[model samples]
Target chain A: MISKEEAAQEAGWIERCQRGEQEAFAPLVERYRSAVFRVVYRVVRRRDEVEDIVQEVFIKAFTAIRSYNFQSSFQTWLSRIALNHCYDYLRRVRASHVTYFWQMSEEGQRNLEATAESREPGGLNAEQRAAVRELASQVLEAAPPADRVLLALKEIEGHSVEEIGEILDLKPSTVKVRLHRARKRLLKEVSSRARVRPGEPAGAPRP
Target chain B: MRCDHVLEILAEGDPRAREIKEHLAQCPACAARARAWRLAQAGFRELASEPVPEASVGFTPRLMRRLAESSRPAPAEQSFFEKVGRRFVYSTLMLALLALLALAVPRSGPLRSPNSAELMLMQPSVATLQDESVLNVDGLGSHWPHNSTVTAPAAGGQR
Candidate 1:
């Protein structure tokens, strides 16, 4: 949580930025670079692309600084911009047919398959751990762009529904409904591929 | 609890997690789904736990350099319809101005109204205008002798 003094100081920087002080923006970027990077990485799941996206998000926020009002906290406003950038990136990547785990190498495929069928995370080595994350990422990538971002924010980034509402500019109730629907669709996708049945244990079949 | 109700509670979380666990113990179908839900949740936790890559050294400096280079706002991309719509508006305004200019200017000089004789001449058919006598009356009335072959004005009118 940001204290009142820090908030006031950040507000000062924003005011300076709004007045065309380019130097004032560096501090804001320094403060939020990790945050923007983490969100972009979680949504897009490409290390090479995260830095470029983070830089672009900051440039956009700086360029459009005049539109920022004090109605919402600076962090929330910045997060909304970051998410919007990530969404656009995801859409373009989806269109290009890249980032689909099925297109990965034989080794990667094996890793994902083995990880998917495993019942527990214990006793997994580093590579297997990475595979677990990759399996989770594939499920998210298969979802629609809006739902993908929401799931990344809620499930992967550990944000609450209310926090998601602020970043997404949606009501908490709306977030819940959309989240519930997204989760259902993903579960159906996973289960149908795996052929999971009542008598059988889950994650037994490879998808 | 129904399978869906139990699953929803499992997936979305609830204060009655104990009840859900009890239901899962009693029901195989719900238990299968419960296993699935747990698996999915575990995957999510693994993803969440992955450490974010640290920004490389000189990230801030590189960004600041890029910012300086791109200080001017990039031109916004317009849709095809937007381009067409903008041109349409410009053309409409140009046409309106032209029409307003046309209305403002006074008509004069060669654009003056024709005399009654010209109006009468214009009213006749081409055949009537082709008549030599009619031409004589309008063109050579005074130059021609009275006794010449040229018909008199009254006779031409009669003709």
Candidate 2:
């Protein structure tokens, strides 16, 4: 829960920044930089792009400081800017390369399918987990910006529906519905595209 | 095959991945569901780590430089009010200078010299005076019988 004192302090800083005190805004940036950076990196897995994206997010927030509404926490406002930048970057990449969400080489697809159909019937080990992460990096970017962002925030960032609604300007019910749809798309697409293994029962779970 | 249940499991991310796997073993539809969710969760976990990075020593300085730069306006850019004020000052000075030169410059033209000897020539001529009198040339009241064409009003007055 946000306290009244913290809110007042943030308001004071905002007022000062709006009044042209550049240094007064530093504390605010220092306070939220890590949180903002994390959100950017969660969606943008490229190490090279992540830092630039994070910098861009902060710069945008800085430029638009006067328009920030005090009703929402400063963090949420900053997050909206960060996620939008990530979407723009994702869109630009998609437009330039015509990358699809499920594009993978035959060997890559086989490895993903093999990982999904591991014979252990046990928990995913470290290597399997790493492979899954690698596959996610590709698929998440290839997926629709809205879907990947929703999934990243819900599953990866662990934001509640209410928080996401405020961040994305969506209703709570809408957030829930969109979140489900995004997960459904990822799960369904991955399952349908994964190749069947040799000598595996057609209807079985690759056991 | 309850898609709702599978969706809930994926969203919830609980009951231990192993327990979910055990349940998936008997349920074919859910097995596939679990497979997808398991892959998704692995990625989620991998990506979620270190949500924020530690700020580098140079980071805040770079940010300060940016903030400082942002507060400073571009060399070529100016506000609307500034442009209007500059233009207003320039226009006002130009008009004032024109008025001052108008007063300081000598009025030596023939029209400006009202007391000059050429003022007599500037007066109306006898012909113009006769034109003003239709039936009286120089007030003699001579209505000539041969001048029938001068019955209408003078067209020269219209010019």
Candidate 3:
């Protein structure tokens, strides 16, 4: 697979693809598949669904490639497709009533607990582990869908704010404000939960 | 400005670091708020960063194969009118250019002759001389061209 930078350097490939040279698009697919997968996986959570969503994102990207102005990085463009697919999937799930928001919240909590249990053998003390688990669950639960998407792209996926803005079709200032708000909300939730729980000391060092 | 600047700078800090430093700061009210916000942020961040289960082992190969299939060339087709329309446009443009050039080029053909009435009408000064002579003479005999034929009429009488 070609590196994204190298694939991007082949400016002629986009033009060729626009001219209906489908073969010219393989390098683009190879370069962006992982990034697209990461975005979809972060939003959808299920491995099987992520695979399907990632494929759909690429297919959509190819079909719409002619309209792409190359104004943003290809990866940014691909991420938008991935994010939109996730949102669509979420909406479908909501409509079907397979899982409501509250149910997902409980599921997320359980997942956090499971993760915390798995992390117990990593030499962390009981109090530290509890704090970590608490913090993780609170952050996940409090973030809105858009904020969750941004957090995934910016923090976990390690995309720059500029890239995130391109993907979300927002200004960098907007992305920054949302990220700050998201972080602030998560912080408040975790700290309040910590104060109420008696097992851990208030000032316990983070694991 | 002081509080705003501090808060602005502090907003960019990692949640854990931000909270610890904010608590140590003198502003108890702001520090408490910052701590709360940071804790909430940390919680959310942790959940968001949870690793996904590894994809099925054959996933990459399958994806690559599908990508390869999608990139394969399909048949190409162009309609008859599409081809004709293109040629028509090209020929029309060429013809227009040729017509314009033909008009622009110098020519050596004979200059077309003028009609007799046109030649006479074009010399108004010549027509005026006849009018001036008629006014000066009381009889037409003075200016008439003759070979012993008709007599001229007097100014006031018919002859």
| Span of ten consecutive residues with least summed lDDT in model 3 chain B | B150-159
Error of 3 at B76 (Å): 11
Residues A1-207, candidate 3: write the lDDT tens digits.
456767556567788878876677776766666677767877666676777777777777777888888787666777787898777776677567654333224544444344332312244444444555455543553456666676667655667778788888999999888877765555455445444232332244446
Give one digit per residue, the lDDT tens place, for model 2 in B6-125.
557646765655655555555666666666666666666777763455556787678778767666774445566678889999999999999987875434324433332132345323
The true-versus-predicted C-alpha distance at residue B35 of model 1, in Å, is 2.1
Rank all candidate structures by their lDDT, best first, as comma-separated numbers. Answer: 1, 2, 3
Can you tell me which runs of candidate 3 are displaced by over 4 Å? Answer: A1-5, A8-13, A21-23, A94-138, A191-207, B1-11, B14-159
Error of 2 at A197 (Å): 7.5
Clashing residue pairs in all predictions, respectively, total: 0, 1, 13
Cα displacement (angstroms), candidate 1, residue A180, comes to: 0.6
Worst 10 residues of 2 chain B by lDDT: B150-159
Residue-by-residue lDDT tens digits, candidate 2, A132-203: 666666657657888988888888889999999999878999998888888877876556555422333223
Cα distance off (Å), candidate 1, residue A143: 1.9
Q: Model 2 - which docking category?
A: incorrect
- Give the alpha carbon lDDT tens digit for every residue of B1-159 in model 1: 677677667766788978876676667676656655554676788988888887899998898889887884434554665788899999999999999877644232123222323444444332323334544434554565544433122224433
Report, for every candidate in turn, its global Cα lDDT versus the true structure: 0.73, 0.69, 0.57
